[model samples]
Structure formats: C-alpha cells, structure tokens
Target: NAGVTQTPKFRILKIGQSMTLQCTQDMNHNYMYWYRQDPGMGLKLIYYSVGAGITDKGEVPNGYNVSRSTTEDFPLRLELAAPSQTSVYFCASSPLAGVYNEQFFGPGTRLTVL
Candidate 1:
C-alpha cells in the first residue's frame, strides 16, 4: 500500500479560522491516529481510533476533533485556529494484526496560523 496517497501540501489560516485536514489510507488497517509537532518539539498525539465508530482522545485533543465512521478516512477538524496550533500534522495507520506494530505515516500537512 502507498499509505496516504495525497493531501494539500500547505495551508494558511488566520486566527478563528476552521478547516478539516483530510487523511485517507488504504482499507487494510484498523487503527488510525492524528498527531502534531511544533518546531523542535516532539509529536503530540491528538486523537486515535481503533476501528470504525470507535474514537478516543489523546494527549492533545483541544481545538481538534476526529471521527472514524469508516475504515478508509480519518479527518481531523481544526476549529478556531490559533498560533499555538501551528505545526506539522501527521496521519498514521497500523494493521490490527502485526508482529512489530509498525505504522505507516502520511507525507504530513504543514499548517500555519497567523
């Protein structure tokens, strides 16, 4: 699988703006996650879903939301964009049955808030 096939390469948002970061992966996995990393900082988990119709919050869930009604799409909604939310976001997926639990990552979306 090519993992994440495509996404907007860049996005610019102003304070209070809202947008959805679309993430789609091959339909072979049962787990998906959303994470964001600020400059020189480690990635922070925003949300994750183990399977369809089951979602859970992660370390950083404020100002963000996720839904998994299907196995292929896991979109992250960023509401009321803020400067503190400026970061590169990643989408990852792992199969239900794996030996090492390796994850496949998307190319990442660069979001800037002003």
Candidate 2:
C-alpha cells in the first residue's frame, strides 16, 4: 500500500501568496501530521489529526492550517505565505495510537517563499 504521498514536490511562492500542500495515505492510519523542516534543522510539527474530522494545532501552527476530512487525506493550507514559511514540508502518518507504531513520511514538498 502507498504509505504516504504529497503533491508538488517543489514550489516557489512570493510573499502574501497562498498555497495548499496535498497529503494522502493508503495505509488506513488514524494519525496524520504535517511538519516543516527548515534548512539544516529538525522537523517542527505544524498540525495533526487523530482521526477524520478531528484536527489540532501543533508546535508551530502559526502560519498554517489543516483539515482531515477523510481517513486517507490530510491537507495543509498556507494562507498569506511569507518567507518564514519557506521550508521542506513533510506529511507523515502512523497507525492508531500505539507506542510501537512508527511514522511513515512522504517524500516532502519543498517550498520557497520569497
């Protein structure tokens, strides 16, 4: 099964523009997350969903938003993007709450905001 997939492998945006990064999984997981990795840095969680119709903000959710309308899809929305939002965004998924579950990450969408 396709663990996770993200669209627009790379993108360049100007200040104040908007964009949506699409993420999907076919693993039937109940936990999905959106994380951003700055150049030479670790990942910072932007948003997450425990299940369909249940989404929540994460460590760094200031300039972003997300929705989990279905079990397989979790899309991240960036409104009025800024240069600070330029980073490699990764979409990850895991099975239902269990300490043993390992997160599966997408190829990542590299966005550069100028």
Candidate 3:
C-alpha cells in the first residue's frame, strides 16, 4: 500500500493565485495533517483531520483550508497564494495520536510565488 502521496511535486504561482494540493494514503490512517516548511525554518502545521468528516486548523491556518472526505484522502486548499505562502508543503498521517506510531510523510510539494 502507498503510505502517502502528493501531487504536482513542484509548482509556481503568481501572487493572489490559488491552488489545491492533493494528498492520499492507503494505510487507512485515522490522523492526517498538512504542514509547511520555509527555507530555513521548522515545519508549521496548517491543518489536520482526526478522522473522516472531522477537521481542525493548526498553528498556521490563516490562508489555508482542508477537508477529509474519506479515510484515504485529505486535501489542502490555498485561498489566496502569497509570496509568504511559498514553501514546501507536506502531508503526513499516523495510525493514532498519543501513541508511539510514526507518521508517514509525503514527498512534499514545493511552491514558489512571485
């Protein structure tokens, strides 16, 4: 089974444009998350879903949105792309929280906005 997958490995956007980043997993994980990493910074969570139909915004969720329609899919949407939003986006999933399970991460989508 594919642990996690993300589309459009690389993308370039103009200021104010929007795009949806896709993420999916075949491990049937119950917890999913979206995070972004700037050039020289740590990963900052954008949004997350505990289970299908349940979602919550994370630390830095200002310009982003997410939805979990099924156990295998959780997609991230950017409303108005900005230069500050340009970063490497990652999708991760774990079997459960509060346990000792490792989260599987996607390759990441690198976005550059000008």
- Native RMSD of candidate 2 (Å): 0.8
TM-score versus the correct structure, for each prediction? 0.92, 0.97, 0.96
Top candidate by TM-score:
2
Instruction: Point out where model 1 deviates above 4 Å.
Output: 97-99
For model 3, the superposed segments whose C-alpha errors exceed 4 Å read none
Model 1 lDDT on a 0 to 1 scale: 0.89
Ten residues in sequence with the least summed lDDT for candidate 2: 94-103
Worst 10 residues of 3 by lDDT: 95-104
Give Cα distance to truth, residue 102, candidate 2, Å. Answer: 1.0
| Model 1 per-residue lDDT tens digits across residues 43-64 | 8999999998999999999999
Residue lDDT tens for model 2, 28-101: 99999999999889999999999999999899999898989999999999999999998999999999677676
lDDT score for residue 111 of model 1: 95
Candidate 1: give the clashing pairs: none
